[model samples]
Structure formats: C-alpha cells, structure tokens
Target: RQDPTEEIQNKREEDLNKKKKKSAPKSSYSSVLIDKDQEPTQSVI
Candidate 1:
C-alpha cells in the first residue's frame, strides 16, 4: 500500500509540474531574456 503522505506529495508535485508546463516558468528566464535581447522593441515600452 502506498503511504498517504508520500502519495499526496507526489500528486502535489505533479500538479506543480503541470502548472509550470502550462505557464512560462522563470527557469527559462535567462534564455528568454537572451532571445528577447535580440529584439529590443518589447523591452522598451
């Protein structure tokens, strides 16, 4: 039988992963910033 606490933790982690995938996560920030730097129009408001 699975321990309830471990199962709940795993489920919570899975939900977080799903949310990260659905939204743009900051882990991609540096690479995204580098790409954005190539085009400055967006940076300048």
Candidate 2:
C-alpha cells in the first residue's frame, strides 16, 4: 500500500512554500510602505 500520509505532508509543504513565495513580494511592499511612513520626506523629496 502507498503511504498516502507522506504524499499529503509533501503536498502541504509544497503549498506552504508556494504561499511564501507569493507573499514574499507583498511583505516587501508593505515594508516599503512602512519605511515611507517613517521617512516620507526622503521618499517624496
């Protein structure tokens, strides 16, 4: 019999990795915004 649990765990890990890749850019964007908030003059000056 195949070990379905291993396959399921692998699939979950793959999904989590995909989510992290997709969200990584978003977090970078938010960080830029946060920095802008802290240094609006630098960003707009």
Clashing pairs in model 2, backbone N/Cα/C closer than 3 A:
none
What local distance difference test score does each model get?
Answer: 0.70, 0.72
lDDT of 2 by residue, 1-45 (tens): 659999999999999978876879666556777876664333422
Model 1 regions lying over 4 Å from their true place = 25-45
lDDT of 1: 0.70
| lDDT per residue (tens digit) for residues 1-45 in model 1 | 999999999999999978876786654454565776675333422
- The TM-scores of all predictions, comma-separated, are 0.52, 0.49
Q: Count the backbone clashes (under 3 Å) in each candidate.
A: 0, 0
